[model samples]
Target: MSGCCGPAPDGRYSEIFDERFASSIARRYRRRGLTAPEGRIIEALSGLGLHGRSVLEVGGGVGELQLELLARGAAETVNLELSDAYEQQADELMRASGVDGRVTRIVGVDLAAASDADVARADYVLLHRVICCYPDFAGLLGAAADHARSAVVFSHPARNLFTRAVVAMSNARMAIVGHDYRGFVHSPEAMLGVLRAHGLALRTYERSKRWHIAVAVREPAGVRTAPAG
Candidate 1:
């Protein structure tokens, strides 16, 4: 979606957000015994029963989760990214994984410019580490919920002493390095309020160190389950 905002004074953060963060962090989860975060995502999603469903991942960097969802039996995966550079990386990753045909990539120039059609086409939507970057947190959350027919899965930094310390350190380091601090820390309660206003019911939630993960199910009219035997 398109909106007017002051141009970023320096583009270093934008550049870093667009570029791939080397292979080290990616490999850490894949080969270095650091699968807990991925495991957390998998477990949360599995609980929602995503087999044969269409999934949309907003701001899915490099399309890692898109590949994983396709592999895990999601019928199709769509990636909506804000950066052309990252979108290219996502395309490359899909091609390298040999799943290009199963994924769709859309580069959104602005979040506010996204459409209802974009939001309404998915049975499931994921927002991993994306909301924290948005200046309008409520708008982003509402848009995500509006588009999801079934559920929205997300992970972000929690509000706590340790997390506050980390944010302070990050701000200090960014100042030292002539870069903008790119982190957004929100309280769990405030986030829940935004979801509730959009008619999404929280299904599951967890906290890991400074990170918080949550899955919220959309309460549409047609989503009722059959009665138990």
Candidate 2:
């Protein structure tokens, strides 16, 4: 929601992912842990041997996913956020989880528009439910792939009639409420095309009724085989 949510008068997009929103997400995470799609992402990344590797997560609200990855053996994680609203909740969660030293949250940084030098490269890049928030999926995914040394994993709304209609309704409601935030159902093929162009090949793809989990990895030299999931 970082790249998609428009800033308010105070220059923060606190209207959406406000303190209450962050606390709600944190409380839900503490009670229920990762969601289904989030679990699938962790399962995929686990197969890559997370021990000692680093992660970069975009729009990681409350830092739940990063905390889980850290528990699963990832060395360090960086979260690039657009709003400062989630910081307090993220900090409290980190402290409560005893992972205060491992996770780094950089607020107000938009990965889509950041330069190569502005962000650090990591072994894996994660974007869970983030693609739908950004209008320029290409720019966002391209930057994700560019920052990934091993794999780029993401989740997006499935391209189907029901999903498209739902997104349209959501956007309409946001407009009606005078919110600049909107949702999009970008073409999965086109999104994958953007990643593939950056030397990442589709490795594992999983689909649910509403979301698609796609994992694309950078293959070693001379490996021309494609992955089937």
lDDT of 1 by residue, 1-229 (tens): 1112222212543555745562444445345432566668877887788689988887776667777777778888877666555544555566777888877766553444566644346888888887776667787787777778888888888787877787778767878887754666776777767777777888888888756798989876645433213
| Candidate 2 displacement at residue 182 in angstroms | 1.0
lDDT of 2 by residue, 110-216 (tens): 78778776788999999998899889999999999999999999999889999889999988988898987778899998899898778899988898987899999
Residue ranges of candidate 1 with Cα displaced over 4 Å = 1-13, 20-34, 117-120, 172-181, 220-229
Model 2: which residue pairs collide?
Answer: none
Query: Against the true structure, candidate 1 has what lDDT?
Result: 0.69
The CA lDDT of each predicted structure is 0.69, 0.84
Best by TM-score: 2
Tell me each candidate's TM-score.
0.80, 0.90
Q: What TM-score does prediction 1 earn?
A: 0.80
